[model samples]
Target: LNIAALLHDVGKIGVYDSSLRKTTRLSNEEILQLKEHPTIGAGIIKRIDFFHDIAPIVRSHHERFDGHGYPDGLANDAIPIESRIICVADAYDAITSKRTYNKPLSPLKAVEEIERNSGTQFDPEVVSALRNALEPNDLPTVQLNEDDFEEFEIPNECDPDYL
Candidate 1:
């Protein structure tokens, strides 16, 4: 379980876009590309010595509790418990993390969103776990003041590339 979850997003390294990687809404092509991350992650784990049992779990973490998820839609008990655990953890992390697309949600808001999506995009059990796991540190703490971006105007003679 640990091994699989740890490597779950490894495939993302190949086609990752730092600018939009954690956005709430992505273009269709970006969504398609993002879906491949799980497969790529599974493949990386499958080649390991003791990870044979973890491959399927890694591959199916993206699946939803209602069988509407990608790759394989093995719902409820059909999905491994370890995978389910990882699912909740992954969701919590994503919800609480700051991204280019959307600011990180407060713990209360994140829980509400997770609970709202229970049984559709996520497992009810996973939702329960998330409700229990939220902590003060789960929220992002980066403070960006307008002064942080303050800079002198560039000279017209300055080369943009060099600047």
Candidate 2:
């Protein structure tokens, strides 16, 4: 699950930097291109033996509980449990993090947004777990610096050049 969470957006490496870094609203073509990330990421993961099992979960992370999401239209149990968990976590992070397109939202506001989408954009069971988890102390916000990461080369199998 953790591996799936970390690599779920790995396909974005293949996306155009302009589309990802643009501050304005994405054009329809850019939106379509952005939606291809999951499929691209899954393809990359599937090439590596150790991560083969997670490729499906990675591909399905964008799937919605109501079967309206992209890449695949899987709904409910049709989607992997790990993918469903990642979907909720991914949405929460996107809502709370500052991006080129939007300002960061407060954790409370983020939770509210997720709650509003329960059973549609997110799984209700996962939503319930999130609510329960947040009922305790507030989660500490961590600010990540680019310097914190050590440079690493892409593995041969996962490298875009090889793919």
Candidate 3:
């Protein structure tokens, strides 16, 4: 699940740089284009036998608990638990991190937004777990941006050369 979580957004690599870096709202057409990332991610993973087990989880991570999300509309228990967990984490990260389109929300505000969307956009249980697991102090003060990439090390365990 951890590996899946890390790689879930890999498909974004296929998105055009203009779309990925857009600082304004995407057009409806662009939104449609952006929504293909999940499917594209799953396809990429499925092609690798080592990651087959996680492909479905990646594909469904964007699905909302209320069945209104893109690519597929799976709701509630129909969604993989890993995907559910990742969805909440992804949303929290997105909300709390500075993005091209918006300023980062305070951790408190991000948690509030997650709590507000608990039963609809996210799994209520997952939200509860998140609330239970993290205090405001546990969050990073700054989002890791491209400038920080040089300092971000892939742990030895994650480097195939080490294996």
Candidate 4:
């Protein structure tokens, strides 16, 4: 699960930097292109014999509990449990972490947002687990400035030498 979580966005290496770095709203085309990261990441992970088993989990992390997400729209039990857990974690991090497009949200607000989307954008069970794990004072607090955000090139193609 740890490996899957760490490498879940590895497919983003194939995404155009312009799309990723855009501060304004993404156009429909850019949004479509960005959505392909999971599949791309899964393909790259599958090439490694050790990570083959977790490729499906990586591929399904974006899947919604209500079968509305891509690349495959898997729902409920059809989606891997590990993927479901990662989905909630990923959303939490994305919400709380500063991004070029948006300001960071408070952990409380982030959790509220996640709670509001429960059973649709996320699995209810996973959301429940997250709620149980978090305590008001235990939430992570990391301060990051603009300097913490750096743009580095990720190889467009998978190379064993780089790995």
Leading candidate by TM-score: 4
| Per-residue lDDT over 1-163 for candidate 4, one digit per residue giving the tens place of the 0 to 100 score | 9999999999999999999999999999999999999999999999999999999999999999999989998999999999999999999999988889878887877888999999998999999999889976776555466686898988756787666
Misplaced by over 4 Å in model 3 are: 136-163
**Each model's TM-score, in the order given?**
0.73, 0.83, 0.83, 0.84
Total backbone collisions, model 1: 0
Alpha carbon deviation, residue 11, candidate 2 (Å): 0.6
Candidate with the greatest lDDT versus the true structure: 4
- lDDT (tens digit, per residue) of candidate 3 on 1-163: 9999999998887788888898888888888888999999999999999999999999999999999987899999999999999999999999987787887786778888999999999999999999878777785555455565565666689678878
Model 2 per-residue lDDT at 137 = 55
RMSD value for candidate 4 = 5.8
Positional deviation of 108 in candidate 4, in angstroms? 1.2
Error of 1 at 152 (Å): 27
Least lDDT summed over 10 consecutive residues: which range in candidate 4? 136-145
1 against 4, candidate with superior lDDT: 4
For candidate 2, the clash count comes to 0
For each candidate, the alpha-carbon lDDT, in order, equals 0.76, 0.91, 0.89, 0.92
lDDT of 4 at 24: 94
The TM-score obtained by model 4 is: 0.84
lDDT of 1 by residue, 1-163 (tens): 7887887777777666742455467778878887887788788878887887788888888888888887786888898877777887788678766657666676667777888888887778767766666654674456454466768876676778767
Model 1 regions lying over 4 Å from their true place: 16-25, 133-163
lDDT of 1: 0.76
